[model samples]
Target: MSVESVVAAPVAKKVPVEREHHGDVFIDEYEWLREKQDPEVLAHLAAENAYTEAQTAHLQGLREKIFDEIKSRTQETDLSVPLRIGDYWYYSRSFEGKQYGASCRCPIDAEAVGIDAWTPPQLEVGAEIPGEEVLLDVNALAEGHEFISIGTVAPSRDGQLLAYSFDVLGDERYTLRFKDLRTGELLADEIVGTTGGATWSHDGTHVFYQTVNEAWRPDTVWRHRLGTERAEDVKVFHEPDERYWVGISTTRSEKYLIIGLHSKITSEQWLLDSATPEGEFQVILPRREGVEYSVEHAVIGGEDRFLILHNDVVDGVKAENFVLCEAPVADPSRMTQLIGHSDDVRLEDIDAFRDYLVLSYRREALPRVAVWPLTESGYGERRELDFDLELFSAGAGSSPEWEQPTLRIGLTSFLTPMRIYDYVPATGALLLRKEAPVLGGYDPDEYVQQRDWAIAGDGTRIPISLVWKKDAVAEGPKPLLLYGYGSYESPIDPYFSVARLSLLERGMVYAVAHVRGGGEMGRLWYEQGKLLSKKNTFTDFIDCARHLIDTGVTAADRMVADGGSAGGLLMGAVANMAPELFRGILTSVPFVDPLTSILDEDLPLTVIEWDEWGNPVADKEVYEYIKSYSPYENVAAKDYPAILAITGLNDTRVLYVEPAKWVAKLRDTKTGDSQLLLKTEMSAGHGGVSGRYEKWKEIAFEFAWLLDTVGLSGE
Candidate 1:
């Protein structure tokens, strides 16, 4: 018997709740959905799941087929290029039918040193390499847990102690544990509620990690000794201000332990000498309101220096574009410009090493990597790695050593699979390490990738990247999946997706709307799309969709919009503002209740988010502005497009209640009968399902629905 035969669609009971802010009142009818512990809430969620399953029952075959296509195109068993750190070459391998990968490392002998060390040792997909020590087998850790996430696994300086953190549920809170490599046994030490990473001291006796507050914000840094109980861990540093979160990391040079406290607009760093495990942390440049910067320890001309990538003015000149400067480590305020600010380049980050410095930046709306050679006289020539592809992403890979000459970089494009290469800066040669294996005879030349622009509402140009099979369409409108996430300064860079081929092969064009809120253009681009200028993000996406229609790329009736998290907020806003523009909308863990969420300082990460979305609770003006655009608050009684809202039961980032309440209101208020579905992942969190196989199924479910909505579900 079919599972859907006995289950029926849910009808949520509406209980009006009046929420007041700034002399204004909001009557939220579906507020009862927020009662997560209520029996009715669970029943409603289950009913919704059952209804979604019933409605899409016919797509089951298609979903499995799509999942199979994804599996077939991807190598079931694969091993990553081994990265050398200290005396070991570390790599991870996935086995066929396993949900997780196994982390392994092999010892480095004399033959595997020097230039050859830069190149990764190639191993067959399912073959066992000699002298490989199993560091952490995630598949074993995930044996019984329905949802298991290996947060961060970092080995100590001597590579004898392994500090790893894992989350059994979807909640971001992870439990950190230690393992002894020599004894091959789990240590007695364990720390709970960590944010998932540990920074080990140079001597490996103490490890620094961040712990979450009641609001789930990592607001405190604690240092733990190797053999002590977790309660004995010292609170090394605490960020009292709720607006800022704290993190700890060791510099690439292994010279200092940096405890960074930052919010959206402001940042402050405290540096502690790595050699002195028990020492005071000194502030490096006090926090400034608008100025933001990052520092890396470097040695140039036989003098100790700090490489600062900042938006601070030098002397009397203002640096609109972030400039690269060098300063004495003792006094970082006394700075001299090394790389002057340029309108063309947006300096992103600097990875400093003993031999050279690798800069990851963006130019012409594309990511670029450059190497600055170190010399006795001063810093030598700065060389930017060249790429032949029109639109691709290239950035530094896992080059962890301080004195390594060759840089490891990763490159990918819309049509190209991920490629790892070793760039020898001295010789100006890029040695190909490995290109991602696409098992079923995939060809990059069979597809097309393009970078197009659309004129936004305020005359600003927004970039849109498009990819589709070559013979899919030559003229007229066709099925197009327009994806966007224009918030949090997160750029949706072009990369290969094995699952996306299902859409492309089925005559669906995939497009990414690089709207203003993203970091694609520059700092100003993000500045314009946030806070008071936030509406530009929604209008920019609308303009991109209209541009697609105007250019005969796709018709409005054949288009579907997709975004998640902050982008899911974009999806809600655009759906409310322009319901007729899209045939359907796909939102994952949508943050639709922004006004309610940001106003409540108790929610996870809400206070820290005030910098991104202004503090609505204290300021009436900010309250009004956010309330005006908050998707859930702004939902009106109008015809709307078909919408599928997906959420995780344990999502701490954007609660499942946001989407649960959103769909209930939409079903009750929207005039159209276009399908409105909600699917809550019972055992997942912000990232949905944890395992690769389950995740692939979830992707197939969403993709199949998209194909069905766009009339491309037919064989």
Candidate 2:
């Protein structure tokens, strides 16, 4: 169980592959790892896993202790708040030993009406309801498979038929299946190779689904009759542009079927009446470069209209953060401004219902929700749902029913477990339905959550969210773990985690760096940290680390940095830029070889990413710009912090080879004797291990390494 037993790290065979782009040629010694099916590649990955296991064998007890702490804090047997759709109230339940949740529903009380009817039923855990029926038990489906993921669960308008999709492999593609809820039998109709979601026709005779192209982009929508064969399904819509991916969904009103086509920045929506299953779809707005819009069906002032949330130029002024407009159903081009754009607030989404419209937005770097009433007269004044917490996130939750008088809003913070509320618009009452159970008798007052700022090189103030146990920092400069994800306008909001308590109890501080490239501070924040300005993300993170050190929160030697996916790319970049700022770096499925990947058109999601990273293949400046900072290309023969890179063999988004090549290059080049390890999950995908227990183990593995690197492994 000693590190000495692991004789040496796995040496990846050097098979030089030349990649030339924009008159620039680069030799990649580990490019041969990209051959996923090759026996040699698999053997190398196995060897890497073996080496990682041996190097960390002594931490087995620590990992198990963390995992057990997570398990004990979580309520194993629980049921979700049942949502009323039609004649039934649907919910899911998880048993103590089950790896997956069971989808179930019970008949709604016909006697209840109005607000009473809209309220979600409070179901007890491990209790059976009268006339309850199990729709899909994922645990049963996952019995023989090492990994199983349920993608979409859609029931017919009448609640008699269920159409769902699941993936046995960790890959994104799924198989569509239908279940007869009344008979408790599965239909003979089965469709494979779909993107995992389906929209049903009003009459339940047909369902529309999407399939991916060669590059794993969902580009084609197909319509399948309930009793028809897969080959008989008609291709209803297809997007030929590789930059745009397509998806199909029905609005909450169930009045219109929408086919949404989107790239990084631009979007176009096609609409079809739900009543007509075989009708052609009409584009509400043609595809316009740099313009994005989403449509929702709304009945306003006794007239059918389409509420369009868009970022288009109005009166020669660009609505960069988006504005809401209403147009007649017959002519969507004639727009009437409803909600104008604001420089301070970014309007993210508007969900239209029969009684009201829910607005989800971001302001002051916190998520906010507002309700606007819709009556026969006109729209009422918007009411913002305010909370007392300054460092918390609040937004709309699951509200599937169109006529429901109550809106489901979820609120949480670093110290608060998720609390679900039913907001009654008419009375302005927030009814507390349920809060996620933390079974360890945890106290929110025992933890401290605060917001701090770091000054970037360009004078931008990047926000950092810090959370630690009240007693952990009394002695000053405790071990700190800094987490970051700054990409694709995706904001990592404040939320509660049960597993995080393990770190807090052990006297550790957890902080999140709200750097640019995220939508935390609004659209402009994202704009400043993407493409040519991506270096800002790395620099901003380093500045945040320095800020923590300067403020006496933690020293460089006591800090560890962690990020995953696009955030994983941040970890790699920062490790190369400022290795001295931390004792360890943990990256999951890191995009280290960006320049090489983006230059190859054959790679999955390369074309769609051009808007985010710039078209490196077609532009010499972009090629050189990416090569300058790409972790793999810039890795030097210098000392580095301890590094642990985790990846999945079936990850289609960030290929496993990216991290494999990254680790191989680091091991071969880096000067330090710091322990470098790569652990690839053989049966998982982008999200890692599928089962809850397995996922807990994965987190334990990472957290344990973090603790050990920060000199608190025994704790």
Candidate 3:
């Protein structure tokens, strides 16, 4: 038999399951695919994988070429700029052929000025630093495992003990482990199913971490002593509400341990003095519905004050744009507005220092940082750090020490490589520490980046970031891949990617659509595209693609689109709404069966997602509204753009069954002969596959397939 005949796609056996919601009846033929562990389901997924490999067999060389191009552009052996925290200057280094890096630290020079004074060692890429202590060799730990991810690498305050968390299966449920850094020996204590973030107490005798529930939500915080068994760990706090997930962290100054409970629309924080490790935590502020706030401990005017960034009513004014407020630690409810709320500026975060307060906010849809110097009496004038790049991203980096005089700032754009800067507040100078080493002599001037706006159906302007090589001239409409993820209020900001160079070098354009569901334009932008307004997210994406076609950037026949997770929902909706706009679609871990998934509140993360997506089980209107656009329910007898849905077996965020059922339905329902492929990573979870080399190869495969779909593989 021929190889093609041996790898033909499997036809899924359908046992139609009739589901009723809001008095509406629906017949789902592929519902049986949700039985993930069933032998038949596994066989079907395996068949799909074999079929994907067979269909793309011709593009194996192209995939390798793309992977090599990515490798050639990246600096395989590199060292990150050291960040000073406490008495050590810490950094991670990647070896030439290693899949992971080594986290190491070196003692500060004894001749430094102040008690908190430290200077980063200036070392060559391959040169070794003096007194370098390897804290964790991830490459060594990753050996013999198909998937390994190091979640948290936190060294204790005294730098004697290291609390690290790692996941071996890509399931995100990490195992918390400890090591005696001085002796280079592993501790016997091991805690499983942790969220991975370990917060150390001031004396370093205890570490606090959160444990994940059955639904994979971190809901309980536990404190484990250095020499105690995991079973003896004390439950410091437990959040009974399923919607609110919990996390624990210590203040930068190591003064207090914070237990944060977060839901979709509400948040509550509890504080425990690091000095009193066993003491009960006190609530910083009680939780209020529809109000969100974060607390930062700051010492001002000889008194410790809580600097809060919140969206609560202030002076009878609705805090639409978040306001920075100061509240006495004793009386947290009594807030004094420090920086009054403005319609244009949205306060995002506040990082407190011993002598200054760094405010990160958004103005004009771009991130801006302002430094407020602390005086004996009060705060002085706020000075904003200016950047020359018009379309770039800049924010605070690893400023670990609370008393440091310099702020580590990270800057990059679509065309620029990642650059690290040390901003000296006193001199107001942005000293360039290091720019990511791009192998083969890369120049930022060889690329062009621009910003354009697409008018949405409702007259809302959606931002689009475009980047391409300067020499890749477009005489006519070219192959363009537009990407978007417009959920969770997360901003899809412009970033530099060495692998993206392969596409741009091959005369392909890459654009990111900042649709309304994201926080790109502030909180209002996200509000208008979620819940009942969710359809706007799909429409906004469609509008952006139409605008690109109208502007002659790419024709409908040459364009491809992509989104992952919630954004995958957008991809599915667009495929149903405007399939003719693109030649291909890439949906990664897609949340396609929203109506069915949301209706089953017992499913993982379903209850928590009620705020982002309305509670379809309780509200009939929500059920009907969601059913109208749910990708799996909406698939009909029409031509769909060639689809490539990628998923993993152990994904808790969005089950692999979503894409599995989605592909089965698409294959059975769609009229056109366009490709419908599903590639399931049997050993991996939501992240698809682990290991740096494997990740690069996966991207190469996807890019090769995309290039082939648009007839650009030969180019």
Best by lDDT: 2
Could you give candidate 2's per-residue lDDT for residues 1-715 as a string of tens digits?
4555776999988989888887888999999999999999999999899899988888999999999999999999999888888899888889898788889899989899877888777788766688888898999999989999999989999988999999988898899999998888899999999999988998999999999989998999999999888889999999999999999989898888999999999999999999998999999899899999999998999899999999999889989999999999999999999989899899999998888999999998999999999878989989999889979999898888888888888999999999989899999999998999998799999899999999998898999999999976648787999999999999989999999999999999999999999889888899999999999999999999999999999999999999999898899999999999999998898889998888888889999999999998888898898998899998999899999999999999999999999999999999979999999999999989998998999999999989999989997
Clashes of 2: 0
Cα lDDT of all candidates, in order?
0.89, 0.92, 0.89
Give the TM-score comparing model 2 with the true structure, all chains together: 0.99
> What is the C-alpha local distance difference test score of candidate 1?
0.89
lDDT of 1 by residue, 1-715 (tens): 3655834556788788899988998888887887778898999999899889888998999999999999999887888888888888899888898889988898876686568766667777657688889999998998889999987989998999999999999898899999999888999998988899999999999999998889998899999999999888888899888988899998988999998888887788899999997898999999988777888999898888888888876667666569998999989999988888877788899988888899999988899999999998988889999988999999999888988888899999999899999889889999898999887778888899999999987788899999999886546898999999988778889999999998998889999999988898877788888998899999999999999999999998999999999999999999999989999999999999998889888999999898898988899999999888888987789999989999999999999999998888888788867888999998999999998999999999999999999888984
- lDDT (Cα, tens digit) per residue for candidate 3, span 404-500: 8999999889988899988877768788889887887788898899999999977888899999887875688989999999998888887899998
Q: Which stretches of candidate 2 lie over 4 Å from their true place?
A: 1-4
List the candidate 3 regions with Cα displacement exceeding 4 Å.
Answer: 1-3, 114-117
**Model 1 TM-score relative to the real fold:** 0.98
C-alpha positional error of residue 29 in candidate 2 after TM-score superposition, expressed in Å: 0.6
* TM-score versus the correct structure, for each prediction: 0.98, 0.99, 0.98
* Worst-scoring 10-residue span by lDDT in model 2: 1-10
